[model samples]
Target: MFKSIRWRVTTLYLILIIAALLMFSLTLKGFLEDYFITQLEDNILKETRLVRSLLKDEIVSNKRVKKIDRLVDEYSNEAEARITIIGSEGKVLGDSEQDPLKMENHLQRHEVQQSIKTGVGKSTRYSETLKINMKYLALPVKHSGNIVGVVRLALPLTQVKEALADIFSRVINAGLIAIIISLILGLSLTKRITKPIERMTEVAGEMAQGHLDQRLMVTSDDELGRLSYVFNNMADKLKNKINEISDEKNKIEAVLSSMGDGVIAVDNIGKIILFNPSAENFFEVKEEEIIGKYSLEVTRSHKLDQVVMESLEKGEEVSEEIEILYPEERIIRVKATSIKDQDEQIQGVVVVLRDITELRHLEQVRTEFVGNVSHELRTPLTSIKGYVETLLANDNPDSAIYKRFLNVVKDEADRLEQLIIDLLDLSKIESGISGKGYEAINLNQVIEDVLTIVMPKVSDKELNLKIDVPAELAMISGDESQIKRLYINLIDNAVKYTPNCGEVKVKVYEDDEKIWTEISDTGIGIPSEDLPRIFERFYRVDKARSRNLGGTGLGLSIVKHIIEQHNGMIDVESEVEKGTKFIFYFPKVK
Candidate 1:
């Protein structure tokens, strides 16, 4: 059976209460008994003293024995006593309640012998004549300086016994009442101590049942109160710690669930503790089947296990991109990190797998593109260098042909310089290290200035330039020079690439959230497949024609970075050989 705190406390309280009550009852009983006996003895001694005083003269003259006996007999009945007169030899001479003549020698009686030997004695004894317990007191009678006889008196102690019995009854009744009161008080006190503890027990039990928000209330500063205080503190701390852990767990869960990559967590013992949706999908396993199982068994990826173990042994983060071979022979990039504690101990490992198959393909395309750009730029550069070297070897350095060759060298030099500068600018932008000074500027003025600077190029290409900007065009926040550079790069490319009589148009508009601009040109368009990589550094579609037209593949890349620095986005739409359009969104000025 289960015994609760209240019951145990009540039982203990009752035990202690009973023990005390018994002791008090026993002590009262002994004291009352002694009191009763002492009172009886005192009464007996007082009677003997009074009677002996009355017999003093009679005893001294040695006369009136019968008269004295008669007198004793009369008063003894009133006194409620037994009276006896003894001679100096301790022999009974007269008795008030017994026949004096028939009485045996009284010398052996304790009271008579004591009076004879030492002048007085008192005792309690059983009386044969009365057949009851009685108290006896004796006093010596002195005559003419000689002890003549002793007058002894005895009284029945029945009244004293009755009075003591009455007291015992009262004491017993009082003790019973006191015990009852003590029991009530003890139970009440026990309840006080145990009630809170009992509540704590219940709350703790609830906590064990997964109600982690359980708490305790404090009531006093006694031991019980101290216990309660401690209990409440413990509960509060536990609740806070659990809440903290729960919140962190929730945050981690949110991140893992929403991520585009797969995440898996394993404990130090190589057992899987956490696996997100992506991981489950990637591994083709359910979370229920994988959790609490060995990572090797669940993931079947030895590369991941080896990485985790290495990170644990080194007590550091270990990263390795490995292909996880699935049941279908599909591969993925797994990036693993060791989970560490505040003490720098490796507690577990987390692996994030990113599917980069498309990115890998793009990388291959970029490599081929760079090679093509190299070949395209080198052909023109090599031709221009060969023509200039040939012209330099001639004797006539100021002829018309020489002038034409110098012009060609100058054009090629400009083209090469533009290409180098564009590449350098793209590198700076992509690396997030653009050194252009930044400040707020009127976006309209920047647009006007770039258009004016590029008008000559527009005329040279016989292209029509259209500007449709409102007077209230939103002010832009960026480096004014970089903004100009950004516009020039885009406009120059449009004019240079567009066919004669083609239209180069620019438009600006605003919505509640942002200001946007679009630059559309009837120029050579890019293929849909290469549209995504157009903003990549050193990427060009028509590489040979772009080099001949003084094009640097970095123009679009720099534009991307400038927009990014202004916290904007750029999107492009193009049709192969039909037209190209670039859209940029920027935050409106405050």
Candidate 2:
């Protein structure tokens, strides 16, 4: 409770008020007691004087002791006091409230001795005879210029105490009233002072909770009001600064979230502090699960950990291509850089991972393509060169020898021309330069046309070409030439791979949503591993056989590209030595 400013203020106020009231009560009570005692003493002294005056002449004239005693008692009763008359010999000659014979000597009495020396004396003390506290006054009575006796009077202090009690009660009551009033006023003043401070405190708490718009109300022009104004101004500046920071932070987050490259940030202690969405997807872990965990624990990639550590230790950027196998097998190019502060101190490490699997695959394909093209051209050119050289060397050679060499040259030349054409076609399709001149093409008609073109080769092989196409199949959206090429590639590949007398089947049909086609061949079926890559350009399952059969090895690759250009899907199923089936689906026209 004392932590509260208002409570402390009110408590201090109450303490001061109570202290002042207590001091005032003590001082006032003392002053009143002294005054009442003095007045009572004075009244006792006056009554003593009267008793002495009444007895002075009588004592000088030797009046009866009994008479003096009666007179003293009369004066004492009238004054409501005790009176004593002592002779010059310090003998109590007469007394009221006590017999003179039983009384002690008066000369040694404090008041009597003082009165003898100073003519009058007064004292306050407990009286043995009265058995209570009393005020005493002593005075000298003289006659014929000689001291005859001392007259003393005493009064109990009970009345003075009663009067002081009454005054004390009144003072206490008034003090209590004043204190109550002060308490109320103090509470009001404290609340007024502290209410604004309390409000500012509350607003500051809200601001801490991210409610930056919370503000204080300045209701006065006092110190607290000025403080409120300052606090509000500070809050405004803070809010704007926070907003600016938040905007910048949001922009950074947006860039990170939208990035295709995975980004992970670790602190100086090697704990993961940030993990973007791409990083989560790349690592196959949730950000919440891995945040604040050690980088090595989450990724479990030695290369990734080494990259980050090397960057942090060397305060330089490190990059490497690393393969991850957990989520999926992918080649990722990672660039790790050490983050620094203005002081150029290494604060953490930031790692960016770009997936380069496709790029790497493309690079390998290009290398193989160059090698294949060189080999293919070399063989044909070598043949043509050999044939022409033989003809030139054979002077007066037989016509039959010349004709056979020329024929061999022509065949090689034709193969070279066909390989060049296939290369150009595959290049155009892969580069997305195959122009879109689409039309509604009949699937059955395209199949029939492709069959007619390959019928001679099928007949030479004696393969059973079975056609199961629906005569009235739905029309599909495609370029007519590309569709015909797609059919020709499928049927031609089947006939080339199948041995003599093998069965080749072509089927075309339609479902509610798509046109479907399947080509099956009883050929040397592709292996499971090779099936995935059979559609790559220049890839051949049986290289020698493919070349001998006049295949350029770009047929299946072209077929795939054509299907994709028409937004169709193609899949292949094969079993070694059993058969292979190529199935394709194209969306049907509404």
TM-score of each: 0.49, 0.92
Report the alpha-carbon TM-score of model 2 versus the true structure. Answer: 0.92
CA deviation > 4 Å runs, candidate 2: 1-3, 57-65, 87-91, 105-108, 116-119, 140-149
lDDT of 2 by residue, 226-334 (tens): 9999998999899899999999999999999999999999999899999999999887899998999998898888888999999999999999999877668889999
Candidate 1 structure quality by residue, lDDT tens digits, 1-590:
11866667666767777787788768877887788777766777788888888887877666677877887897688778888888777566678887777888887888777777787777788888899988888998987778888888887778777887887788779877877887688778877877887788898999988887777776677887888788778888888898899999899889889998988888887788888998888778999887999887876878877876776677666766676676544456766778889997778888777877668767886887688569657865997989878887876776888878878878877777777676666667667665666667888898999988999988887888999999977676777877889889887888887999999999989998788889999988889999999987667788778767776677887888989988999999999778899999888778
Evaluated against the true structure, the overall lDDT of model 2 is: 0.88
Model 1 regions more than 4 Å off:
1-270, 274-319, 323-385, 388-401, 427-437
Which pairs of residues have clashing backbones in candidate 2? none
Give the worst 10-residue stretch by lDDT in candidate 2.
57-66
TM-score result, candidate 1: 0.49
Error of 2 at 165 (Å): 1.7
436, model 2: CA deviation in Å?
Answer: 4.3
